[model samples]
Target: MTRWDAVRVRQGLVDSCCSAEQAGDQALRRGRPREARRHYERMLAEAIRLAEQFPDLSTRRDLTLAFNKYGAFWVGAHRLDQAAEAYAEGLAVATRLREENPDDIRLLRDLRFGEFTLGEIARQTGGPAGRRTAHDHCTTALALAEHLVGTDPHHTGDRRELGVVQERLGLLATERQELDEAAEWYARALSVRRELAAELPGDPRARRDLGVQYERLGDLALRRRDLEAARAHYDESLSLRRSLLGDDPRDLSTQRDLSVVCERLGDVALLTDGPEQARQWYDDSFAILDAAFGPKHPDTRTLRKKLRGHPVTPN
Candidate 1:
């Protein structure tokens, strides 16, 4: 092939990857995880091929992004193992890229994003050791985020990431039973998110980030068995989520998030009110999930189990 033809061919592959990733994102937003997976697979395959053939900066960057996005999708689908594997792959690629371009802000952020994601997955995997590893990884990411923010105080992306890192650090502290430290981190993150959300009220991503801070606080309160505090935080989260859902009811990802808040509220209700009140909350969650993923899906099935057995939630 002529050099011109080769360039065109590679460009075509890159275009295909871009389209596949967009399609995957759309599918995920609409609550069609299975459909999203197919598009993500296509995007990942093209990205890998491009990197293998070219091994150029652009190609490698695309490869890392593909893995990271796929990892995010797996996280939404509640597949921690798949999420971890994808994040690890992204980290491996991003580590080399960051070393080569230490001054490149985007590359540095990519590496930190990978580390941050892997840290969350480590916690989800569950164990004393896992929590310790998560704490270390997140602490490293927190320092990096702080450096990024310090370098460019006005950089919105850096600030946003800093908030997310703080949120995770708060969760890690909560795991270690350091409630005071956790509250401090959560407060810092909340302030950052409030700024971002106020700056971009129409941006769903910004609003969701803010909502997540409240949700994390709610989870912490529940851990303390403070039902009233948990309910208040969850109510705030649910309000933000509901507003987002109202903007786009067809968004499955948002629906899932709403369901989580609803279910958590149900946990609070079960403790405070009774089975009947909690049942109503559970039904609300079930309705959303059943509509989004059908009753046979694992999420719905787990909800059903909760309804039937009413197992005592440790939280």
Candidate 2:
């Protein structure tokens, strides 16, 4: 193709990528995973075609953005392997762009996000190499986030991203049973999330992460037989999740978790009280489970059997 024709074709590809990304995002938000996948795949293919059709456009910021967006879609779809590949491509492009234009702050930020995502994927699928890779990438991303927070405290997105990285770090520490370290990380993340919530109460991601951190702490407390601590943390988690999710059927995961916590607390009550009070707690626990899982669910059936076997009497 002639030079002018090539430019037009590249622009067409860019437009196609943008359209695909928009469609993919909509599909994701609507919980249409299959449709989202199709859009993201199409965007990736178009990006590759553009790269081959016009080498000059391959490293352009727009093209890099397409890769990043596609990677985000893949991540949302739980296609972590594909997400990593897309992020790798985007990172390479961003690196080249940054080298050529050292003053491009946006490109630098994108590179950091790419690295953060890579770390997330690695952390989710653990082996020795995966753990090592996750640690390195998360450490690098953390340093970058810290720098951003220090230099630009008003940048809410940077602070939020820092909170996310800290939460992930907490998860890693928790997995290793480093309770103190995990608590420290989670506390920092919670602080950032609280700040973000104060500024933008409508944004729920930070709040959700905070709930998750609380639940993790509750699990640890339970393992140590710290019943009071576990109860407190689980209560906090349930309250937050209830506020954020309400009675939405899609939030059954959180609902089930809350029910489990209630059942555990009921067990504690059984040990401390006579049959009447114990039975009350057990009834409440069963009610929560039935509401969360429905009566026909396997969990409900199992809990029902347990309740029947225990046969709490009215004192």
Candidate 3:
């Protein structure tokens, strides 16, 4: 084919596959899963074709990313088997690339994150047997997280990722009722996140990570029946989350997090304060969900159900 023909083919690939991917993203943000899936299916088909046709670094990288996102979508849709298959395929591609470029930062991050995501899927997979798989994935991810951070300790993103990895391990520990182990992991995560937040006070993501660490610690405190500690941690998270949305209360992501803080505070309120205060907090949380995602949304409906009862439970 001539140069012009080759250029035309490349443009066709962009218009066909990239455009589909973009449309999928937009549909996902709008909560149109069926529409998103249609677009993603097309994008995946094209991505596979592209990778098979040109097994170069860039095409292979795109293929890896395609599988990564497709797997994530399956996870959200509650298709565990498909999610695992897609993630495993992505990891295989990524592993080949990492072997080729041993010290490459991008590949290192990809492998680390891929492991972490796989751990999540494994944890949610076939009940008891999934636990061991989940733990192994998380352990490998944590090691990669440490290695990535060690490669560039000054890199803020890598440091933050280390904290996230620690937090994921902590979550698994909590589910296993290993409170002490969970606490240790959470403490480490909090330390790293706190330092990042303090160093980059202006960065919204840094503050948000610190806030999430506090939220998780607060959850642990609640599990231990340390009401006062839970309240204090929740308060700190609320403050930080509020700070992140100072002028943009409409920011759905921050608002959703803030809603969690509110619901947790509501739980504490049921114990410390009266039911009135607790109801108010729950209302605040539900209102955010109702407005952002509509009342018919799963989350909104769940919260609405909770609001129907006495609201004494700690859901």
Candidate 4:
């Protein structure tokens, strides 16, 4: 079958789920966690039912995608345990596929993605023990990603995966308080992401990844109390995120990112511009999040608490 035909077939296999997943994603971006979770659960159930009923390649791939999306949704909601479980489920499926088709690049890539995601969740919740587990998973993921890139240097997806692995290594190093090592890994990730963005200027995702690397660098600088460096990095990240938002105003995730950078800018303003300036920054951050996710969302609530000392202008 042609690639387009295969895509259509896959869509048909998962059509019952497409609307639920889309609704879930929209709710997630809008910051309604409960609603998003409900929709995602329905989507996952549908995916699982279809996969079990058919047990075909396309259906299995759809199932894997559902699990991965579920994991991502949980990660955004800060439900690390759920994220881990979902990722583990996806990993199991991917592993089975890889074992059956050792030479299939797509299956291998899926397996690598699963490993990397589980590693990330582990790093977030497993504490020191989790970090170790994350390190091992990331290391293996990096090796697989490298092999894939070497096999197909022109494949942008493989190259992007390599960059993602490097960024994870940077995060692991930061968790260990290995500043120099963290910087080294972050620099490598930035280099790769920048190259990809330059090559594909129209690729918003590539630009977003580049923004993420800058934000990571900004975070590391903040931890080190390097305010100037943090400010510069965050400014760059904000600019990119703003451009992305301008390009797609309906993207709630991008809107959330604007809130994040605004909060960071608030931090810097607090340190450099005193109470009034800081309040303005914080207010901007809170307003964006409040509009998207409502005032009761955990993130919006947390930002509200941060604004406690300041007089909040009514939205």
Candidate 5:
């Protein structure tokens, strides 16, 4: 093609990408998944066309960004497989660009997020090899995020990302029955989130994460048969979650987790003290679960059955 023709194609591709991105943003803001997906797909196509027309470092970076945005959209839609594939493609492009321009911090951060997403996918799928890969990817992402934070301590985004990565790592460890390691990682993540919450008092995400970490720590303690520690963590988690989420439906998970912990604590009391104390604790747990999940919910039914001398599935 002639130089003018090539320039026109590149400009057209850029315009299409810009327009598609605006549409995608608007669709996402309006909570229209299908519309957002269409716009992002169009942007991805235009980005590929631009890369072909001008196969330069800058065009490659743009393509990477497009893929990253597409991946993010997929993630929001809960399409883990598609998100992983998009992130993988973006990572490859970003790695190549990073080799040419090593100082491009944004590319580096994108690569880290891609790796983190890949790790999350592997963890969700589950398997020994997948778990190992997830752990490795999380470790690398955490290190990268930590480095970013060290370079600029006020980089709240990086710090938040690091805390999330740590929390995921802790969860993976917990799944593998590595209670000690899980507790340690969860504590570290919780510390970072607490600091973040203090700095950005209005941000609910940080507070929510800290509450989740406390819940995880409580689970780990319970698994280790440390009733006192478990109770403390559970109480803290429940208090924090209640303060933040109140009685909103969004707090169901936290409510369920607290109920489980309460039930477990009752079991411990039964083994340690007398039946009366255990019954009181069990009743408290049952009341909470019944109120939040209703009498016919699995948890409430199981608890009721247990009280009636039937086999109950451990929470």
Candidate 6:
């Protein structure tokens, strides 16, 4: 082909890749899963072709993004096998890129994300071996996040990433019933998240993230029978979550979070404030969760079990 023909072919390929990516992202934002899948699959195909035909660093990077998007789509769909395959493929490409450019911070961050996602999937799909493997992967991700935070302490994203990794470690410890270790890890994450929330007081997402840590800590306190401490944490979580839910009352996840915190507070009240106060809290939780998730849902069912012997009046 002539020089002009070659340039035209290259431009066409780039346009195809760009268009597909844009379409996929737009579809996802609009909650059109079928359209998103079609666009993402097309993007992946184009990326793969570009990677092979061009064999350049930029093309390979695009291919890596394609794999990551494909994996994330499958993960959201709960297709674990497909998610695993996509992640593995993307991770392999990321690993290669990391080897080629060890100092590339972008590649390092991508690797951490890939590893974290894979570990979470393993953790959710339980087995002794799978859990152990997940722990290892998450530990590696924590190390990477720590290093990144050390490199840029003022970077909010890096700090949040470190906090999340610490939280994951705490979860793993909790699963193993290592209460002391779990508490220590959670405390570290809580410190970071608290700082982040304070730094960005206007950001609801940051506050919500801190609230999550508080809720986890509350759960830990309950496990340790520290009723007062549990109440304090739950109260803090409830405050933040209420503010978040106030901004978007229709967000079912936020509503569910508020319900969980209220239920925990009721558990504390049951022990100290007697059945009347406890009953009020329990009823409030039941109302919220029953509305957000039907009475037959697991969350509502668990709430029912908790209220069984107590016999609270349903609203």
Where is the poorest 10-residue window by lDDT in model 3?
A: 306-315
* Tens-digit per-residue lDDT, 97-145, candidate 4: 7777778888778888888988988887857999999999999899999
Tell me the lDDT of model 1 at 237. Answer: 98
What C-alpha lDDT, on a 0 to 100 scale, does residue 89 get in candidate 1? 94
RMSD of each: 5.5, 4.7, 3.6, 6.2, 4.8, 2.6
Model 5, 151-216: lDDT tens digits are 789988889998999989999998898877888899899899889988987776777777777777
lDDT of 5 at 160: 91
Candidate 1: how large is its RMSD? 5.5
lDDT of 1 by residue, 1-315 (tens): 899998998999999999999999899889899999999999999999999988988899989999999998999989999999999999899889888888988888887888887898999898998998898889989888998999999888899999999998898888789998998999999999999999888888999999999999999899889899999999999999999999999999999999999999999999999978897888899889999999898999898788777754311
Can you give the lDDT of residue 143 in candidate 5? 80
Encode model 3's per-residue lDDT on 27-66: one tens digit a residue: 9999999999999989988888877766778778888899
After superposition, the stretches of candidate 6 with alpha carbons farther than 4 Å from their true spots are 1-4, 21-39, 290-309, 313-315
Q: Spell out the clash pairs found in candidate 2.
A: none
lDDT of 1: 0.91
State TM-scores per candidate: 0.72, 0.73, 0.84, 0.73, 0.75, 0.89
- Across 156-275, the per-residue lDDT of candidate 6 in tens digits comes to 998998899899989888888898999999999999999999999888888888999999999999989999999999999999999999889999999999998999899999888898
| Residue 145, candidate 1: alpha-carbon lDDT | 94
lDDT of 3: 0.88
| Best-fitting candidate, scored by lDDT | 1
- Candidate 4, number of clashes: 0
lDDT of 2 by residue, 1-315 (tens): 888987798789889987887898898889998998899888878877777676553436666777888787777767889889988888888888778877666876877787888998898888768877887888888987887788789998899889888988877777777878878887888788878877876767666766776777676677667777877887787677777666464677766766666666666556545556656666766787788778999988887887887856322
Off by over 4 Å in 1: 1-101, 309-315
Error of 3 at 99 (Å): 1.5
Global lDDT of each candidate: 0.91, 0.77, 0.88, 0.88, 0.82, 0.89
